[model samples]
Target: MDSILNPSTLKNLVFDLGDVIIPIDLTAPVRNFAMLANLPEDEVWAIWKEHNFINHYETGLLDDAAFRAEVRQLLKNDVWADEVIDTAWNTVLLDLPVERIARIQELKANHRLFLLSNTSPIHIRRVNDVLTQLNLPTLEQLFERVFYSYEVRLAKPSPDIYRHVLTEAGLVAEETAFFDDNAANIQAAAELGIQAVHVQPPMTIIDYVKDL
Candidate 1:
């Protein structure tokens, strides 16, 4: 528990999905793409990063068809199947630890919990499938509201998204706390008078709020 987030004053908790609740392997996609494209891993990674297609897709600027087309074009492999593209794109997602969900369930007793994530439809569907496979509740059942970048057309580190969450949840900035693995997103929330924690590896959400 950070001193800035005095438990006495916080009434709402906003969480980021990737690397916060769900563990992700950022390099997994690169490896997957390399295998799919039959290209060197470094070359595939360079192409992926240079295209910046992910940002557009996550932000809702690109739809599924367009995203797939862009991926094929960027990788210079026009003959790849959609399944191959999807598999490679989704390799970045790993698993959602059950302990993390249990911790969130515990926190529900005290504060209004919400999920704010920068994600695409493909990734979210995969995550939901995992939850179902594990017999855990869907995200909507676990959190009061789940906000996704593709659905909302807004991404974190953007002030508008934070403002939208506060307004939609009917929460006051001063009474809310946000936890994210990204420093930029945390700082954006803090700038709006919300208590923000920069969650890092080896420090899970359970550790952050257990004391509070």
Candidate 2:
């Protein structure tokens, strides 16, 4: 994604929740798991990669109880309660800076902002709690509409989800800008003719749209 922005051409700004609008440390949960299991982060990370079933929860294939059961099994003799497991697992979600909310609101003056994220119910619930703590509006209040993988049953890097957003929002592919932290999602949006911004570290949505 270019550092400059052309608000004239980009009328709609579509954002990803994690690591985009909200700052999240993907490795935080792994580190927490490592602490729980008293193992090295690398070992826990490797195990997590091998047994990544959170996607099932994100795609709504597994309910919260089922997903928690999977986590319990993953930990192997942790015997932690649901609340304990939820707090540990939800460490993947970091704080949502009030500045990010302000930036989004500033852009919302001219752009139709929308949120699309691949997140599970637990994460979403935790996010709202964070928002409440920060005195920020709900995700729906911040954006025109929010599309969650769990609710929509469609994950990103899949053309179908992008198509669904386009159709549902009555947005033209050429006029929309999709900002995400994932390269695959950026490629998917680009392939569908949307302006895709690869929002990597040290560069945020604020930097991506600095010109606007």
Candidate 3:
């Protein structure tokens, strides 16, 4: 993986959604589901790991109804309604930091901004709804283009997803820079010649773009 000390020549900036732009508590959904099952959070997470509907849902292999059905069985009791199931499932998403949003908006003045995220319809709906509630612009409005894994049927850490975005957006690999919280995703993008930065936190994309 490579990091450009000076990103002056990069024409496009690609951002990963969760953690990079918006902070997420990965354990939140597990905790929420565990409450429903009367199981410990770790136990519910273990069950989730076994069934692994997360990857399937994010990759578009499962719809909301199918996902809820699978999750219901994890409870070992009566099924919960769609509203309850959705609210519980969406607990992983947290509020988007206003500072990060401002950083990206400033970056947009000089660079073509794009958002590429491994996300599901359910997750994105909650995000947009929150943005609406906050009187903030939606992701679509913030980015020149947004590539969602569920909509595209491709998820990252996969080179194919990176390639798909590049080709579809007519972006040159060398002229673009990508910021992601996931190392695998950063590596994949870097392998394709995009300037890639692994955003290790307590640090963020703002750290990379704040002075630019």
In order, what lDDT does every prediction score? 0.89, 0.85, 0.87
Residue 119 in model 2: lDDT: 94
Best by lDDT: 1
lDDT of 3 at 6: 52
Q: Taking the tens digit of each residue's C-alpha lDDT, what string does model 1 give over 142-194?
A: 99999999888999899999999999889999999999999999988998999
TM-score of each: 0.94, 0.91, 0.95
lDDT of 1 at 104: 90
Task: Choose 1 or 2, whichever is better by TM-score.
Answer: 1
Kindly give the stretch of ten consecutive residues in candidate 3 with the minimal lDDT sum. Answer: 1-10
Ranking by TM-score: 3, 1, 2
lDDT of 2: 0.85
lDDT of 3 by residue, 65-131 (tens): 8888888876775558889889987898987788888788888889999999999888888998888
| Model 2, residue pairs in steric clash | none
Better by TM-score, candidate 3 or 2? 3
